[model samples]
Target: MKFVRTNKDRLVLISVAGEIAPARMRSPYSVTTEGKVKVIPVLGGITYNVRVGDSAYGWEGDHVEPGVSVMARKKEEEIPFMTLPCIGNEVIVMSGDAKGSRGVVTGKHGGVNHVIVHFDDEVLEKLMVGDKVLIKAWGQGMKLLDHPDVKVMNIDPDLFEKIGIVEKDGKLHVPVVAKVPAHLMGSGIGASSSASTDYDIMALDPREVGVEDLRLGDIVAIMDHDNSYGVGKYRKGMISIGIVVHSACVSAGHGPGVVVIMTGEESVLVPEVVERSNISDYLR
Candidate 1:
């Protein structure tokens, strides 16, 4: 069955499913319906409305996808503006309508889910629990990936916008943006949302490593040196796309975690890249 939503309101972040897809499942999940067991496809791996009867449950380890709604942790702080992180990290809305708002960051979950920040008590009192937020994306090396020349495995929508790609001509036109050799990507792909504080790069292209170059809302591809996606043998070709979940950090065996990218149509893989476009510079 197809999902129903306005084309403009399409989702980028999706939660994980307990039952694997046909390809991922050694044994798929099913329930007895009448006499036959049936498989269920939980959309976005989550239920938008939380209820006791809901099939989904919250997990401490699960993170929020960027661009999703979040409320303030409390109502004490004073935020003059609605804040969005350029890099994923814990934040407290210091001022504005959401002032005194605080939330643990669930990392960005969808293409539009560029910065997922969770909220707590104080912030919740002053703000609604789920409010669509505006983010300011800045920094360098952020761009779009287009062209049939590469392979992309598992992706969401937010990364698509970050790369600056627009669908046309019955094919995706990924621009020639900057690329980080698969060898340079850290071994642990998922780890920290606050790269600025949680982890650090043991090694990075001195040219590409820096806060100015990597900022919030930037789409990037992790070079798959081992061809983990099986695009082929150790060829310098396969690239796994993901949005930077946070800034560079020094997490154990992990640097910056990425909200893995995915494609909505056709089983085609496209390379991801980094580019700069946020005019607000985190002010939004």
Candidate 2:
């Protein structure tokens, strides 16, 4: 809990199911120097979905190279405060008797901090586990103040009470969920880490993100930010967004819906007739 790195928006980008890299590279045995010194072959380390306490992914082992150090505790800012804004996407029920009861986020398994809310199925049959859920985070990256190209990322402002999309006369309705088209989307924008090494969307299919058309409160949109749709350096014209945290698996090009959240350049905002809200429901 003492990871003081505040920019407000306390970090929440869960993703882990498969695909990892760096598995071999053994080279160590040199001792001949008189004026030159060079040795390189580390090959491992740097798989941070963040895991240390609960275990299952963030233990800090398995890999981590770039200057190799460990004790970590350096953070001068960035923790403005974020307990649940979009702990996966908007939540409620602050105390007992399902205090407020309301949920959405369905995944945050980054090394076991736990955060997978859904509710319904009879309130998840009644709810259990730890039971606390009280998030609001606050209008995640809110935009529209002047249309910047319309870009919202990892939202969780209580998700406009469940989910609502609005665009008016231009087209782009909402409700129903699952769209994953725009050309499959896959490349690498800042490199998301479910575990490590992942970024492929070449022509997906699977009935266009299958699962009867993706559900569990779907919310996806990854229509090219750049890299043509796969190397992720994207930034031109910005518009790469995502949210469908789960549902869709067969592994061809893998598919369990997940992007938790993301935005583009300056944060993205360009409105002329775009008004859909669900950025984690006004940040709990």
Q: After superposition, how far is residue 177 of candidate 1 from its true place, in Å?
A: 6.1
Candidate 2 local distance difference test against the native: 0.35
Off by over 4 Å in 1: 1-115, 118-163, 167-171, 175-177, 187-205, 208-212, 225-235, 251-253, 263-284
Deviation from native of the Cα of residue 80 in model 1, angstroms: 35
- Report, for every candidate in turn, its global Cα lDDT versus the true structure: 0.32, 0.35
lDDT score of residue 244 within candidate 2: 43
In candidate 1, position 53 carries an lDDT of 14
Best candidate, TM-score-wise?
1
Q: TM-score for candidate 2, please give it.
A: 0.27
Q: Worst 10-residue stretch by lDDT in candidate 2?
A: 64-73
Give me the runs in candidate 2 sitting further than 4 Å from their true place. 1-115, 118-133, 144-147, 153-181, 185-238, 250-254, 258-284
What is the RMSD, in Å, between candidate 2 and the native fold over all Cα? Answer: 18.2
